[model samples]
Target: MEIATYILVPFILFALTGLKVMNEYERGVRFRLGNYSGVVNPGLRYIIPVIDTMQKVDLRVKAVDVPSQDAMTKDNVSVNVNAVLYYKISDAKNAIIEVEDFKFAVSQLAQTTMRDIVGETTLDRLLSERESVSLRIKELVDKASDPWGIKVNSVELKDILLPSDMKRVIAKEAEAEREKRAVIIKAEGETIASVNLSKAAKTLAGNKGALHLRTLQTLNDIASDQNNTIVLALPLEILESFRGKNK
Candidate 1:
């Protein structure tokens, strides 16, 4: 009975101390007595009870929110902007060894990088240059975090918060631009119409019968408008011939 008790007690202790379970999306980093140790694969793992410590790291993509930062543009405009970062741990060993807190370091780095980018661009560029801005930010973040085994997949500017007065000014400026374009388009159409009319007039003047036909067409168009009042202008020679024929 005493032998049985000893065996059962040690079995229970081992089971409680050495057993570790890792999910499919997690990997465990094992260290022994302050020395570099290998990574533990996903599944059950056994460690020497107190001599080894394990860190469970998630392998899946992580989404981090970059808080709003007030940044001054190159044009001396102040804007508040916030962004999102999609990242993942690429090298588990380096991630464990290089940084004490990789996540916080990355977050801080992103903010500073964003500010730097904003400082280099004007407000118009910052607002209009989305693809370029995102690409630059992602490249910078990835380079900065490479030492920490962090891979920045993509960076996106989620929101740009501008002042109400700035919004109003921008809107007005946009409206003016649209109005200018409209005026230019209308003028172009009028020029085209004038050229077309001049060409038609020249063609009709070459044909003697075209003027009469065109005049008849104009009268027909006016009659089709369902109006009763009509005014006719006849040449003096034609009116005189008509009076002599009637007499």
Candidate 2:
């Protein structure tokens, strides 16, 4: 009984070692006798304990945050930029066979590509045209990593840091632009007011009593504020009217 018990325990342990269970999101890359066998899908799988080995790979979309990298823009502005990358493993076999470490390789490639793209772009465009730059980065990265079975879905520019001097310069430039626009608007308003004033003068001269009526309205407006005193030098028209009224 003792001899039979020892034999059964060893057999049971060996059988248990051959069984492997994979989840739905995982695929096993199998190798038999050190030669590539193929992929084993999720389910109950068996491999010879000493002759076969398997590596499990998760087939799911992943988000990778790229660290900030310093780069000089085409206009010679130095800036720090970081981004996020979304990718998935399209082909598990090539991912393992072609790249030593797929995730690290993709990250390094993304960093270099970002710096390259930033170097060719102006600071203004990089700040304003962020979406286009991100799309371009995604395209370049996807193309470069395609061989390693990485499918880059999208890339987003996370943050852009500018120097303090650059920020101050930009603020000053914006302030100057606002002041320029205000001056133009004020000048336009003055031009319109002058044009209306010219028309008003012409209308008053064409009509007999319009100027006197306007003068009376102005006096009325000044008199509405009782706390103020107004001095007026009566015009010759007003004097003539007063003389005619007396006659």
Candidate 3:
């Protein structure tokens, strides 16, 4: 009885060691005698003890944050840029076979591709056309990583850091542009006001009594403020009219 108990214990241990349970998101790449075998789907899987090995890979979308890279723009501007990369493993077999480390490979590929795309783009376009540039980087990286079984979902430019001096220069240029527009608008307003004043003057001159009526209206406006005193100067036309009335 003691000998049978010892033997069964060893057999139970070996059987437990061969049993593997994979989650829903996991796939097991099985190798038999160091040769490519088949992929084990999510469930209880059995492997021969000391003969077959399995590597579990999670088939899930992953986000990798690329560190900031110092890049020079096409317009000769220096900037620091960072981005995020979204990717997934399309073919798990190729991912494990074609690359030593698929995640690291994709990350490095994204970094270099970002720098290359940034170098090709001017500073103005890089600042303005972020979506287009990100799509371009995604396409290039996706195409390059196809053999490695990585599908690049999307790429996003997160932040762009410019030099302090460049920021100040941009601020000053914007201020100057705003001032220029203000001056132009003020000049246009003045030109319109001058044209209107000239028309008013011509109308007042052609119509008799218009000037006197305007002067009376000004005096009435000034008199509306009870705290103010006004001096009225009668024009020569008023005196001539009075003289004609006396005659």
Superposed by TM-score, candidate 1 places the C-alpha of residue 138 at a distance from the truth, in angstroms, of 1.4
The prediction achieving the highest lDDT against the true structure is 2
**Segments of candidate 2 deviating more than 4 angstroms:** 1-4, 191-220, 227-247
lDDT of 1 by residue, 157-183 (tens): 989888899999999999999999999
Could you give the candidate ranking by TM-score, starting with the highest? 1, 2, 3
Model 1 whole-model lDDT (C-alpha atoms): 0.90
- So what's the TM-score on candidate 2? 0.80
lDDT, candidate 2, residue 157?
100
Estimate, for each residue in 1-247, the C-alpha lDDT of model 2 and write its tens digit. Answer: 9999999999899978999999999888889998989998999989889899998888899999999999999999999999999999989898988899999999999999999999999999999999999999999999999999899999999999999999999999999999999999999999999999999999998876887788789888888887758567589577889999999
Per-residue lDDT tens digits for candidate 3, residues 166-245, read 99998998899999999999999999999999999999988869877897898888878877575767885788899999
Q: Itemize residue pairs with steric clashes in candidate 2.
A: none
After superposing candidate 1 on the true structure, give the runs of residues whose Cα lies further than 4 Å from its correct spot: 1-4, 226-229, 233-247
Q: Report lDDT (Cα) of residue 151, candidate 3.
A: 94
Selected candidate, larger lDDT, 1 vs 2 = 2
